[model samples]
Target: MKILLLITPSEDIVEKFRLSLKDEYIVLTAYSFEQGSDLIRPDQINLIAIDITISESDKIKSWFARHRNIQDIMWLGIVSSDISEEELGKYSSIFHEIICTPISRNRLKIAIKNIQERLDILSENKHLKLLSIAYTEKERDTESVIRLSPGPLEKAVPLFRTFTASLDLDKLIDLFLDAVTDVVGVSRISFLLYNKEDDVYRVKASRGIHPDISSRIYLTPDSGMILWLSTRGRILRRDKVEGDVVSKGILIRAFREMEVLQSVVGIPIMYEGKLLCILNLDRKITSEPYSSMELEKLFILSNYFGKAIQDIYKYNIICNQKEYTQKILERMGTGVITVNEKEEIIIFNPKAEEILKEKAADIKGRPVEVLPEPITRLIRETIRDKKAYNKHEVISEEDNLYVEVDTYGLYDISGLLIGGVILLEDISAREELSREKKKGENLQLLNELVGRMAHELRNPLVAVRTFTQLMKDRYSDPEFQDFFFSTVTGEVEKLNSLIEKLIAFAHPIEYKFDIVDLGEVLDNSLESILRAVKTSNIQLIKNYTPGIFKIRADNKQIYKAFSYILQNSFNAMQSGGTLTMNVESVLKDATIKISVKDTGRGIPPEDFKKVFDPFYTTPEKGIGLGLPLSQKIIEEHGGKVSVSSVFNHGTTLTILLPIAAQTEEEV
Candidate 1:
């Protein structure tokens, strides 16, 4: 039971105090403030209660010389209902509690009990010498311990005060180790806490021991030292417990493990019935064995630490939960904002700050007006109408941003609207991807157009060179001379209009449909390739359906396509090669199949897939545009191209065109 003092002239108030505190405290009474000052012992009288009107704080301070211990005492003030506000406020700072009279017995008992707990903690701190604020500021190193205060209690005042200052587990261990070093003047120390998951005690923090050495040291449940600590439930010394040598069962190994950790003493801190931590210590700097008083102080400190560990873990759980939530928000890719019914921003994630170009710190907790007009409109609309909008695209012309927004109203368990949530995704990036795709398509088209122009110009140049080569042998033949001259002139005219062909390619080509003979078109294609060839041993074979091969089609385009195909077939050979043309109408399929086969160098296996890609080429091949241009022309006339090849053997290129309406003209 604690001693209590009541300083009030009111007999009725004093009677109420006695009834409330009679069972728990030694009730002492004084009639006035002057009389109470005489009873105040500063250290012994830790609790005091008085009528608010009678106590003069200045007079009491002057009489006591403002003792440090006196300030720590818990004071309770009792004031009447009619007391002025100024006086009530004045005493409020001086008292831990200000209960208005006439106070109920239960209320007085509760107030006094709370103050009693405070006073008990204050008394314990004083006993540990936690009186002055300067305790935490003092150096806790070895030298400070050497320049020591004589009494153990006097040296402990600052160290014990430092103990209660932190709730952080790691920092608290550091302080505890430092305090032990300061008070006990030990050369080395290590603090270990029990890990529930591992069922072992591991060093959480340490001093004096090598940094790498202590963390690796631990005590398992079955370890000799842990077993001893669990059974003994007290500090372990190197010499003996109950006057037996530590060289016996368990103690021998326990002492050995402690020696490895640079410790000769181990103090086990237990809470309730469980061991919470162990404080391992080496010898003192003075090389003297610990006194009984020093051991007693350590036990007191260890008891306090066991309780502190529980509180620290509780604090960490709450802090971790909040930190985990913050990390999730920081990592999200979408802008997220939550608001209250008053239209104030409560939560603004990092993505919101980036997308809106606004700082979260500046805009959070502010009204929705701080956001862009479109975003604010959505928030207001959702809150006012209590509806949800999904995938709402907002093209902000003035801000020049394309954004997709989603908004929903938030509600309570009772179905009343509490606030609203807004989600934003910037879809402008998708627009950029779409543009890049279009640009790639346009680039491919340009490649084909340029490739077509190169193919046209190269064909005429090859013809002029072939005719000139034939002149070397047939210059004296009249028939060959006339045909050569006419062909050469026609080839030169086509070369002169190369620039015009380019202009035609720059725009779109309009194919003119006409009634034409398909057999004549194949003959003209074979003749063009024969004129371009410099070889004489080349053989041509043709297979055509026995009928009038007439169709409504673009005659020039079909001729140009066949001419390039035959040219490719002949160009595959250097001197002697056989070129076969197979043209047939499949009446069942309603199509024309033209197969161009060459007994020349075939395309490699790897190059087969890229045969029709514009500008794809091989060594000594003509500009690589012939086949792609031919394929494009056939496809424009509703046809498809196919290829098959055998390396070094031969290559076959086939064209399939939708057979158009038949005409009366036959070839």
Candidate 2:
């Protein structure tokens, strides 16, 4: 239930509203703006209806505009039909409804319902935004707790455990400071390593100290406390010394200036009976002195720390070697798996996980029996023979999957059998490529048949032309002459169709667009071309990236373009050659590059640029449309085709295409 306030000085409005006003609303009436201002209660009033004919209506509008609390209430204006456009526009923004001279109760109810619905929607939106912000803040808080809770020493211990031979000195010092600070309960610590040339122990690192203190403090042979410690290489505590010695020494004076009030302890780190560095700890702004137990622990820690420091080079060497080996295993393109004598998996690298489509954690320590029959048999054979074995295995678990697996018995340095190792190289695409090459051979045979077919049709074509000419010359009759001309035209058209059929074998028809993987298209094209060149003594190598290679393109047209380029390479390498195809995405350039390099009789430099021109051919028997058609297809996909060659060396052709824009998940 809500209240409505009505204001007007007109008798007619009062009379009309008195009769038509709804009973559900708690209505209040004011005859003047001053009366209405005093009567209005923002919390109680949900709607306001003001008659513009009243002399005080402008003053009422001004108050409503200025008071934000009142502005939220739905407003209605009672105006004459002749209200000017400018005034109407001004009031439209402020008022939810307008009533003409004759007020209708139904119209007022509808307006109120509409405004309430809009307000409800706005409230819901605000609520949702608040919830989103709250969730985001909760996530940030959780991350902050995890990141900042651990102490420096706690974090460094793991790094120490993983060490092989060497250690980072700076990191070691920081960790030592943290350990000492936690154990000794000191506010400040500094490590001053002996600098022989300077004849002083200079500050190498410090914790919880002002920049000025770190920069200025140093100990030389003449310094009081340092000189006293030099002779014995023992721990020194300020409280144990005579009061005068404690207060008057240069070290004490420096510590006082830095606001270290209670006490100080110095422990020297020695290696092979030679002084290395001094660890200085200070009790600052507190009256606590170093305890006997703290001093005992400090000596033991210093001894351990000294030995660790001496072996740092060894630790670093071990760490580096481990990292190097791990990086190699992770980055290898071949799948590597190792099994112990019990035939249980011991090592599974990333490539192994990818090829097998299983996680290392799930497979490691699992028996070889869990593997497929072919792979299991191969592993068993190698283990039994105590020798190396190699085999090509076709896995039809997925479409077009072929792999070459090499298995060998693993041995210890003593030449004793310990385990077995399996290496897998995917050759599915290569196998498919062999099939495509066979298809190319068939296409070549078809081409030869077409040529013979053209020769066979030529004799009949000639006879038809000669016979038609004779008929046209012998018969002047209009109907007979027309029939002869038509027959000759139809025969000529048939010959033209035959020539078109020949060209069709070389260039395919236009294609529709599709979302396709460019890498797959390249593999398919090479497979087709490989069959024709297999006996030509040519070798094909393909290097393609393993991730998203999708692009919006006409798959058939792109396949045709790739085929033409591959065929051209085959033609150039008639005797024998090697073709390398590499496909990789360049994110910074926002493009993908497909490079086809051939070791063949290379194109001359002068004709390199002209190779893509229409009908441009260097070889006497060349059709010249291959490169031009490839260029057209690439350009149509918002890409470019380029070539580089050195005479008698080789030629490399590159095609760059824009990567298709995709949504986050698709990318």
Candidate 3:
């Protein structure tokens, strides 16, 4: 039984009450009301044996009233024998039980024992309430912290930016480790990236520890803890190890090497069901084991980190591909132009700029068609094909330029066609080289022919001159001498004609320009050929669409050029086939086009190109200088000639000429 005996002044009576209750129960005594109040907390007090006659009685009664509100302590009051029943009645509302002086020992024992039983029940209820309040407060604190905690997702922006900006893999790994260390509150962190090619895990990033320590650390499939965690793709904690294998050798060695006397946590970074790396963190600076809250945060952060790593790797691959493409473009002799779907040029490389004699800066955003005609044609072809096309040796007759163009389709990741790229190469130099080679070969053949002809003609001419002189000297008849002189003059004229033809074949035309109607020139030349071949029963067909077709030309030279082709057609139709002539105007470019076709034995395919070489001949009487000289004349007028022939079938020749100055006004 536990009893609280409050003995107050009126000092003699207080001592008497203490002596009575001290033997019967575990007694607690307070001598004053102030002392009594201090001792009467929930568990410490049960029965109050007070001295009723004391001046402090009302004060003690007030203290008992305040304690009653607490509901955990039993109150009993002590009184003097002189106290009246009415006085006891007045105080009855405050005290639960009251005892008078000169009380029996048995009565006091029973009272004290009864109070002790009540106190025991009260104590139990009080502790239960305290626990409930404590739990609620603790939950509130945790919720507050969680709400305030920087979420794993919040780091993504900076993490992604940093990861993508770093080119070096090691530097990227280090940044990832630093972010992990900051989040997890870990004292040390390290990253072990798996090298599938080597079949090993190499430590790549470390914090709060020297890299030398990481260098010394190595792991393989055979390594127990590392292998188990990596294979399971689970978060592993040092304290959670279950098996003897984890407890005995490998774990011990790892802990010792890492100098982690406290807790350790490891998480595997998995991508596409394959283990990519391991993230390891040691106990924090305070050596506290990682809390459940922190571990959960790490789990979320790791997911974000894994995705960021993949993005960075993908970005790097794209950058490297761009670099490789640039290198390839630089190495190529051709020019490259790339444009987006909007038809705006984007990638105009140095070679493309140089060939066009234009800068990328001046034309990048311009429409593709706004570029030079050659480039525009290439762009259009690429768009039409949706694949690569190679156009070799496309000659621009107006510019006298030859270029090769190769165009390819550009595609994106999903194999969707995006745009097109054009590769341009100037093949004019190569064409010129081929022409020179042909000229050299022809010159060699011509020199051989000329040497033989000259040797044969020189002796005959010398004999004729000598015979003419001898006749003049020996003949007495004047008429005979005159006939011998006439023979001499005829031989000299034949020799002079041969020499003039040789000179014409050897020299290229020198330009002399004047405005002339090419249509009228063609008409006059065809008329002359018809007259010359009057005996041949060839039908001449004319499909002439007359417009102001004019060009700047050396009129006589151009006349000769037209006459040579007309004569050739007349000669081709030896059995009198049809000769067709056509003329048309090109309005967009202000040029004229003329076509001449012969239904006669055509030149062979092999001889088409060779027919334009100087002195090349097929007919016994033909000299190839005619076609070659005609080509030179047309070119000098900023025009071009093209021929298509099928052997023994037919032949067609076309010429393109710029409009002359006088024709511009009429058009």
Candidate 4:
């Protein structure tokens, strides 16, 4: 189909060849051997026709040999009858066929046909090579997808639920191994769960390999491939390990036992950013090397397996917590309900259903507003306030349930409002408890009142007895009588002081509630305490921030609460250690918190929760009423008292109070 013409200096012969082949072929004509060689392009020239009658025939032959080195070309040498057979023999290797001086058109067509078939075969071979490369790439991609796809156990919801629901260590490990084997498509699997307590990695579970091999394969920081992978966090291909002479012994033994002659892949399972275990898969049963694609798939699959393991562990923790919470809720005398953001009831415990006279099945999917009016209002208020609200002894007319409702807002990880939780405590039995508590409080108050009363009465009585004895001794002496009158007046003044203290404790408080600043109150209280206890050894450390921490409370009551806590701290640090007072504004919760910490003898852990109860004290001479009274005052102001203490180390008492309406100065 393609032609290259070698034209000699004889213009007549060049014209004859071009005219004859011009219609049947694409003709390229060159006047000299040098010119023809320059025109030849292997990709374009499929056939060459030379006119050898010219004087440069020998030079033409040499050019053909040189051009043949460039590419395989079908050369058709045209020679005269005078050309010898020996000369033709030299051109035979380079030319496919020879045409004599009287060249026929049919002979030329036959030669062209033979060259066309050769070109077609070459083209077909090139195309087949390209297709082979494409198929290799496709197989690699598919192997990667299979290796990386989430395994049955990885995405298995029921497996996750079961794993999370139990704390049995052995079961958790077994389930993990099963998932890895199923997903990785490798029957030969082994796990070594690291035990920090023992500083060793124990072979917990394995599949495919002999039990004896797994039993002997215990790993430590110094042991085997697992230890290396843990420290490196890189996948170790079997070929790379086997090729290293230093690692040959270990790799050889492992390969021999697993019957994996070709290759293996090892991946580390990381949890909480720490290497928890390693998973290794042997070569396929067909003894084929795991290509680069398979290795990449293993990497992706291992990441998912790691995540599943972490989820299973977290599931178990939440399961335990849920169980503990259920037990506590069932035994509690209070009714509890949890609702989601849509206000639909998510949880209605047995106690809640019984107290409301409704079944859980009927109320679970219902809105929270479906409950009694008081309960609905409580929940709405709590969500609006974004804080806990307590209403004591609120009688619900619908159910005739005398319950104390405590509602609090629930928040998610990002501090976004999720829903609310309500605890309904039945106060029918609590009323009796309250009555008994009140009786005990009154009895204790009475005892203190009686002691003060006796102290006051004794002073006057003593004075009277002394005056009588003086009168009896002096008989009718005017000077002794005057002295007795002066002494009796002084004693009467002492009796008045005792009577005033008794009256102050017994009388009702006539205090008014207003927006008071915590910083100012604390400063004043501290100044008063420092002035009252003017001992050179007692140091008062004030760590108060000068900001208006506004709270709705009785100023006098708050002052009294601060005084009691400060007094206790001062007493505890008799030898004088640091008494830290911390005050700050918590803007996120819209609350003001004040902390009074003492580096003194701390309360015992067992007594931490009981410290607020009336008449519970650790001090030798304490009346045991300070903490209880402080708690009551804060509670009245819509706040909470929390104490964290460590025995013999220190104690911290934190008071969380709602911030009142902000003034222009505060803003």
Candidate 5:
């Protein structure tokens, strides 16, 4: 039967052709040129017919020109219009017959019948040529070939039995040689294996062949027969291929390289569709050439040997991986323990054994009860819920150990929980460091507090002393006495207020959360600093968004924080400069951003980082608790204070706070 492929844009043509040829041919159809090009296999289809109008004639010609391999096949084109004699001659190479649209049924049938008959005659003649070559060579009787071996398969039993018991590739190759020796009088055997990294084929095993010949044979792209075997992956013989063009070209050159003029068989060993190696065997020069049956049996054995070598390579890889993994676990600092689904320990690394004060050999494969209570509980939780537990600290009083244990369930790719893994990290040193840091911070805070108190009190005390002296000297004067009393009372009140603020700054006070408007808070702070701004000839600019920007914060603390920031801006602008305070709400981030920009001399880059550190001051006077305290208050109210300065360009201090959803009355 013949295979016919029809290509056209019309579906009706494909269906009608398929029905007409249903009894005599296997019909395949494609709707586009691209689909037809992919379906054209020279070995499968006998004829190809393409239907195109005048517009797509050039497209089909280009497609045929590019695929020169399909040019050898029988191709016919159907056109929408009649072709002129000159144009037909021009396209004669692309299409054998150019038929017109609405084909004549009788003429098409007659043409197809002639084509089929011609193809059948050509196929038969090709088969006859191959048979003629086969008979010209020497042949052996069937009985004589069969008597040479008891059974080729039965001889391979020992090799198959040793496959599981050994991991030696060389021993398997030796066994394969012995199995094949009974079928053919083997003189020399050479195994050439391909190396992927080097891109070369080297002789791996050899016998009865010169060591120099095997060592010098490195198959590259230019290597004639070796490269052919790598690509074709077919069994080749010297006698049977002398008449064939392609095979003769490869085998004749390969035969010249052999030391002895005898029959040689080249078998390609394949695995996973890749040519892994080539097994070459040479029969004695005096003996008859190997029969077709023997050569076919050797090909099968070559495939079996390839699988054996592959298995050994994989086994060694797995063994190396295991060793590497074990070494890593031993050197790791963190303790590792793995338990199977039965709660029995499957692995206990060296660190785990050292931390727990137990031997790995003694506890491995033991129940979870072998571990301490805390670790046992963590493992149980992970196994029971099939989840991970992390960052839990455990302390062993008897061993004086403090460790952080993280547990996780080990699941396979299919999501089946197969085990649990626990990692233990020693954290005793970390805990000690934390305690010392806290102590240092507290001492520093105390020192800053004492300095602030002294600085605040000295001014008020000096004023009181001066007023008391005036009152003592001028007690008889009524006006002077009234002025002295009033001055003294004001100084005393200022002293009281200073003390109250110092106490609040130095201690932790319970904060009352309420809906406080940030804009109002800034206004109040600006009012307090307005006097300082006027005295310094500084201009103050307040740009507040027209909205009630409220936040859930301690009203008193936020006010204090705003006041401190305003004071800093006043102090920085010693000369006449502009201090712009801007307040805006960022609704997307749910925050209120307050920026206090000043045009005073910018802070030094080195001093910017320490501006908010307690007792860290650049000015000669005053303890530097103002900015630090402001930052602390804002942080306590769930806000942040950031300062950016560009040397001589002045500084900007911005405060961000979360916007409160409640109104002022909701407080």
Candidate 6:
């Protein structure tokens, strides 16, 4: 098949060209003349379709000028309709067969077919000339023998047996090269093998030349020589001027290197219409050009090489896949161990070594019994039963290691048992965390008990208060009634206050919003708490800038919130310690902070997180509802409450409230 040099940036254009010219041409694509130059074989590229916009027109012209021997290269110029009329007209005058944009596959088909017919005629004439020359040579040397012979074709069955039976590709390629030169009686032979990695053909083996010289002969996929060899897929004669590929601009880099080695013939080793490698031969020892018979002998031998190359490719692919699978096993997180049907350990991954605390070198290829007893038993069971066992526990209480093990029966493609595999994962931390989480759930259940306690405790208190009120009202003795109302009523009031606080801590509150000055609110709370509690022995320090900050809140609720914090400080300082109260605006005055610091019996470090938990308290200090309730109210008003303490040193309780907008309303 002929190669059509299809130079276009658009993949769609290349596809359309290939589909349109599929019967006659193999499309070789390049984005520009710079890249397309390498594929311009004198024999293969008989047609070139160039997309010539204004940007590429200059390059196309210069490129055409560089290759002076393009007398037969039919140019199919493609131009977009978007170009200005002046440039279109100018380019039209310079090029023929210039198809305008919006062209269809059928239109392209007609144009390419017209050129193909001309190329066909030209090719036929060249072939006829070659035939005529061969006929003349044959007539002169009628008594001479076809000089070239394949050494193994001299023993044809052996060549087939070796090529079909051998597994090593390198040796097979060498065998093919050897057979090619065996009876040719030539000193120069070069084998250029394709390397998929770099997408080039380099000399793999050679004879009758310096090893250094042979190494320099590299043929890129785009090399004009390679294009001809790949497309023609037959023996090529360097002396055949009509089909000559190694011209000045044709082969480019490959042409120069091939020239250095004095190579005069190229044989393409092809199979299934794919070019696998190339062989270059020097002129015969008599310096005579190779006849068709000689070329024919080498061409037949290339088939065996092609078959060998195919087998080698399959082998490499299998090796790469195994390496890829091994890579996945090495990097995965789960521990994996596989053992053969004979119970010999194999394929111990890194994670398996880590879990078992043994080196792979020490354990692999040993008996499965070398592993822990549980792992060995599981693998044995999985193999014997031909089934999988998932998530069976393996615990080592003495070492505090807990693992979940899963065992599976390994099988070959034929479903026959080949081995067994085990998967392991550490679950010790996860199990411990689950137990701790259950304890927290039990604590949450305790909150439910408080609701029932409130109901039982409040019923008797209500009865006593109601009875005491009725008796006091009807007593008729002034002294007794007055004493009954004061003494008994006071104790009942304390009981009622405790019940209300308990209800408040467990439920949300309703607030009456008002503008309250934070400093004054703290002052009122301090005065009230000091009067209520026996804090006469404690030193009090108050430092605040009055009326500096205000908050939008319920006034009474704000007062109560401050009283709770103040009460905790006073309660902690009963033994004559200093109590400091301070109010300030912080965070660039975005919020107001009220803090009470007590230098007596500070909270221990361990109880810091429990400070705001409801009902947590000591007999000597206020109930835990004081801080938790204050936090609830502060958060409802878009604020935060926090506590910082040093063990046996002091505790500072702080409340932060957002600064509300100032108005005419005052506290």
- lDDT, candidate 6, equals 0.74
Clashing pairs in 1: 129-157
Clashes of each: 1, 16, 1, 2, 0, 0
| Clashing pairs in model 3, backbone N/Cα/C closer than 3 A | 550-660
- RMSD (CA, Å), each prediction: 20.3, 35.4, 27.0, 25.1, 13.6, 16.5
Candidate 6 on 17-77: residue-level lDDT in tens? 8778787677899887778888788644667778885245676677766874566678788
Which has the greatest lDDT?
A: 1
lDDT of 2 by residue, 131-227 (tens): 2321211343354221112353353344345333336777777777766666445787888777778988778888777778687777676665456
Q: Per-candidate TM vs. native?
A: 0.39, 0.31, 0.48, 0.36, 0.48, 0.42
Question: lDDT tens string, model 4, 1-667?
Answer: 3455555566665666677667556667776677777887763465676666654656666766677775546667777767778887876665677767666667656666676677567644543332232222235435432223333434444555555465566776677667645644564766666767777766667778777767665555555565456655567665454346445665455444323312266666665446776666765553445555345445544555566667756777899899998998777777999888778888898899878888889999888888988888777776777767777457755567688888888999999889999998877667768879999989986796566556547858887787887687795788887888877876776466345433434465556899787788888777767765535476556666545567788998888778767766776677767888877768899887889998778888887777775445455324445666677677777888888888888788899999886554442
For model 5, what is the error of residue 660's alpha carbon versus the real structure, in angstroms, after optimal superposition?
9.5
List the lowest-lDDT window of 10 residues for candidate 3.
129-138
When sorted by TM-score, best at the front, the candidate numbers are 5, 3, 6, 1, 4, 2
Selected candidate, larger lDDT, 2 vs 5: 5
Question: What stretches of model 3 exceed 4 Å from their correct place?
Answer: 1-183, 195-199, 242-263, 284-293, 350-372, 384-391, 394-403, 411-417, 426-460, 474-667
Error of 2 at 193 (Å): 8.8
Give per-residue CA lDDT, model 5, range 131-238, as digits (tens): 233322344554322133335445555666776667888777767666566535677777778887888878787777778777877666446656567666677666
Evaluate model 5: give its TM-score: 0.48
Candidate 4: regions farther than 4 A off: 1-205, 212-217, 237-265, 271-273, 384-388, 396-398, 413-416, 432-667
User: Tens digits of per-residue lDDT for model 1 on 1-667?
Assistant: 3467888888888888788776666677999767786877642355788776565657644543453245656888788888888877877766788888889998887887788788668657655443231222235363342223545556556655655666777777777777678767899988888999998899888888887898799888888888888877768887435656654879888988888878888988876556788888898887766655466558667777776777777778889998998899889999999999999999999998888888999998899998888889999999999878899998786876678999999999999999999998988888678779889988986787577657767888898899899898999999999999889998887676445433433456579988777878988888877876789998878877434566667888788888878877888877688888887767788887889898998998888898876556666564465677777778888888999999899999988877665554322
Candidate 2: C-alpha RMSD to true structure equals: 35.4
- Judge candidate 5 against the unseen true structure and give its global Cα lDDT, from 0 to 1: 0.73
Ten-residue stretch with the least lDDT total in model 6: 127-136
- Candidate 2 has its poorest 10 consecutive residues by lDDT at 129-138
| Cα lDDT, model 5, residue 524 | 78
lDDT at residue 364 of model 4 (Cα atoms): 91
TM-score of 4: 0.36
